[model samples]
Target chain A: MKQIEDANQEALRRMLAADPVLVDVLPAAQVIPELTDRMILHAGPPIDWERMCGPMQGAVMGIAVFEGWAPDLETAANMAAEGAFEFHPNHHFDAVGPMTGMTTLSQPVMIVENRTFGNRAYCTINEGLGKVMRFGGNDDEVLKRLAWLRDVLGPAMGKALGAGDGLPLKSLVARGLSMGDEMHQRNVACSGLTLRGLSPAMAETANDTHDLAEALAFVAGNDQFFLNIAMAMGKAIMDPVRGIEGSSLVTAMSRNGTDFGIRVSGTGDTWFTAPVEMPEGLYFPGFTEKDANPDMGDSTIVETIGLGGFAMGAAPAVAGFVGAGAASGAANFTRTMGEITVGENPEWTIPALDYLGVPTGIDIRLVVETGLAPSINTGIAHKEPGVGQVGAGVVRAPMGCFRQALETFAESVGVS
Target chain B: MSETKVNQFLKTPVKVVNIGLEGFAKELEQQGVTVVQVDWAPPAGGDPKLADLLSKLGT
Candidate 1:
């Protein structure tokens, strides 16, 4: 027990010590060396093309076309079905994504380097809300936006970041939490903060004023713009927590619509999986649960390091949008989550909860013992590809994965 | 006959702290009794194998 506790403490210490900085933005192929021409990186655990959900399939087809591997969605679909492309989880390549989370070679990815751990993580920039590719929109409009991001915004932001050392994310997230962003469904504050931090450099580095304005407007307009950056920061922080011997702390939790998966620090990279759950919450006008898909994304990494759902208390404004009861009741979610975690993150405290640290280090042993699943705040996509976002809400990580991980962890510790 | 302790206690404004199932707590509340429902489930969802493993790990 002491060994496990010590290992978990070490994991927590490493996580708290990590300083993830937004270093640059570059093409996925150029940065992730393993990303070959025909390869595509998606969110959640590993799965092949045949099993990908409607939104994921849609995004893949769209990315295929965007990459010039195919001329149209129909052709892309045919090529995908014919094994003309390879599919891998973004996590496999030190990255994370939201919703369908399709990351391809041509898309520019934001790079976050963990200065303390000396490792890096990557994520594609968030496309503004509505019918976008991450939610499975693959029409000509979606393709055109992807092109602009690749050609214009990505390079501009890259040059801006190049002008400076890089943007430090820890304090920005601390500020966002105070300003009512749990860094999942609500990132308005952090998005604005990100623009404020980068605008000066963007102005200094710009070759075209029109492009700079468009890029600035894009970041300012999208409230969820910081979601991808938070995700990359979460990945960078947690990657260093992996492989701590005898620890029961979760290193990652993710869903791919078909399956929800988790990895424990003790078990290394082995994934424990179960059927993914559907989110329960408010829907946009005219849409209902029937239009919603099972939850999917690598964004749950935020919860792994104790932001997102675990910090819901900090963002009372998001309560109604996510159907999480009254704003005052939001703090109860954080309190309940604390029962299943190893400790609190003192650096990221909630003002509403008397500055209590967000619950950190989800311990599988405690999850199994207490029978409480980790909660996630998420956006709901239409089950059908190309329909895009239908709603937003909260979902629970499956308990089966925790139970499986605990069992394996016990066996590994000679408890059998 | 003298009232028993159970009878005396029952007469003093019934209150309940229910765990594991909400139905019991709901029934009490419906009967005009104060009830605090605690959200809970059987450890490891009552899977014997997992419960056993948890016990082995000193749960």
Candidate 2:
């Protein structure tokens, strides 16, 4: 037990000490050397085409077409079914994405370097909400937007970021929390802060005025723009915490619509999975629970590093939007989560909780003992592919995965 | 025999604290008895094997 405790503390130290900087933006294939042609990386744990939820399948079809592997969505779908393409979880390639997280070779990916550990993590840009590929919309409109991101915004931001040393994310996230952005369902403040940091460089780096204005307007227009950066930041922070022997700290928690999976520090890359849960919250008009897909995405990585739902107390404004409850009730979610974690992140504190650090380091031992699953604030996608976002809400990580992780962890430590 | 302590206690105003399932607490509330419901479940969702492993880890 002491060994486990020590290992967990070391894991927490590495996580808290992480310096995730927005270093560059480039095509996925350019940065992730393992991403080969026709190889598509998706969100959550490893899942095959047959088992992928409608949205994920839809996104994959869209990406296949976007990559020119197929002539159309129809062809893409057929190709996917026929095994014309390879699918792997984004986590496998040191990347993460949100919703029906579809990361392909051609899509532009934000690169965040953990300067302290000299490792990097990647994530594709957030296609501004609705009828976009991340939520499984794969029509011409979606393809066009993906192309724009790949051609314009990605390079502009990459040039801006390159103009100087990359923007460090820790302080920006802290400031966002102070201004009511939880870096998950709500990232309004951080998005603005990120634009303010990059707009100047973007203006100077752009080849022309029109391109600069378009790029600036795009970042300013999309409120969840920073969510992708946050996902990459979370990935950057947590990657270093992986493989700490005897540590029970969770390194990743994600869902692929069909299944929710978690990887623990001690267990290496093995994913303990269970049937995913549907989000419970307010839906957009004309939509209801029946239209919502089970929760999905690699964005829960934010919560793994003590943001998102774990920092909900700092963003009370998100409570009503996510249907968590009245603004005052938000702090209770963070408080309940504290019991299941190994420690608190001092740098990311909630003023509402008297400057208490956000709960960090999810410990499987505590999760099993307390029977409290990690709560995630998330966007609800329609179950039918290409329908776009249905709503936003909160969902709990299934306990079955934690139980399995604990059982294996105990056995691994010779507990028999 | 005269009323036992249990009987005497039952004769007084009834107040209850309920944990786990909320049905009992709801029933008590419907009967006008004061009740405090605590949201809880059997650790590990009542999975015996997980509970055993948890105990082994000294949780």
Candidate 3:
């Protein structure tokens, strides 16, 4: 028992020490080996087209139109029906997306590399809030923004990063936590820091002066622009610790609106799943819980690696943002999560905990024993397609997935 | 000061004895965390009927 526990700690230590950085922006086809023509990568566990929920179906059609595989949504829907494309989960290819978590072949994606481990992960560029394709926006306006990102912003970012790898993401995240950004639902500080890093680079990009300024302003205007980078950074760090035999740490936890799934370190890519639950928290003025879809997206990678919601105590404002009600409630949730994690992250301390390190390293065993679930702050998409974001809130990982993983662990160790 | 806790629990082996909810024990078991749950009930001496019988049979 002691040996197993030690092994788990060792793996977690490596994860904690990993340095993930945003190195470049590139077309998905150039960087992601698995993003082949007619194949779309999505979030959570794999699912077939027939079983897809409304928002996912909508996003697929939107991605198809953006890829020019189909001229319009109508054609895209028909193409999917005729099996003109292949569907797969992003986790299979070391990539993740938020909401419908859509990634198509031609889309531009952020490439984050783990400086310490040399592993990489990818995520689509943030569309900067409302009516974006990630939330199933298929209008001409959404497609136009994607084109601008691909042609102008992406090239400028790549130039800014240069051949010399980008800024160390962990350092930025550490500073962000201290400055009241949790790197999840609230990323005001991290975004500001990122823009500051890229401002000089934007000044040098070859794009027309007006276009370049607009591009810089686009990122500057969108607060969540840094979130996709942060999520990719998380993936780059955590993917390296995957499949460490007998190590019961949770390497990934994600939801597909239809289901919530998790991968355990000891289980080697095996996913334990349960039906996703609706998030509980504040909603947009015109929406309510009933209009909100089940929790979805790969953004939980932030919490999976001990940022975002795990550092909630550091960003009390995020509690009200995600429905935790108040700063004290967020603080309590953060402390509870600590009970189930392996240890505190020395680098990212929460002020509410007397500047205690934010809880890090989720151990499957600890979660099951403590009956505590990791709280994730996430955007809530509407159940219907094309409606875009309805709200943002906090949600607990389903206990059932943990239960199933525990059963598997018990059987594997011959303890049951 | 808080940085020192990066591996607080990992430095020690685990042995958790839960006194109430089995759910907590179940959760721990999944992660391979060591947990021992006590199936607790009220003491028998607290029951008036049982207490009276014990008193009547006392030496």
Question: Chain A TM-score for each candidate, in the given order?
Answer: 0.99, 0.99, 0.97
- The lDDT for every candidate, in the order shown, is 0.91, 0.92, 0.82
Give candidate 1 misplaced runs (Cα > 4 Å): B1-14
User: Can you list each candidate's DockQ?
Assistant: 0.57, 0.57, 0.02
The ten-residue window of minimal lDDT in model 2 chain A covers A407-416
True contacts kept of each: 0.61, 0.75, 0.00
Clashing pairs in 3: A364-B31, A365-B31, A368-B27, A368-B28, A369-B27, A369-B28, A406-B30
lDDT by residue (A286-366, candidate 2, tens digit) is: 999999999999999999988899999999999999999999999999999999997898899898899989999999988
Name the weakest run of 10 consecutive residues (lDDT summed) in model 1 chain A. Answer: A407-416
Give the clashing pairs for model 2: none
Give the candidate order by descending DockQ: 1, 2, 3
Report the C-alpha lDDT of model 2 over B1-59, residue by residue, as the tens digit. 45798798878999999987899999999999999999888777787877787777764
C-alpha lDDT of residue A23 in model 2: 90
- Cα error, candidate 3, residue A237 (Å): 0.7
Q: Which portions of model 3 show Cα errors greater than 4 Å?
A: B1-59
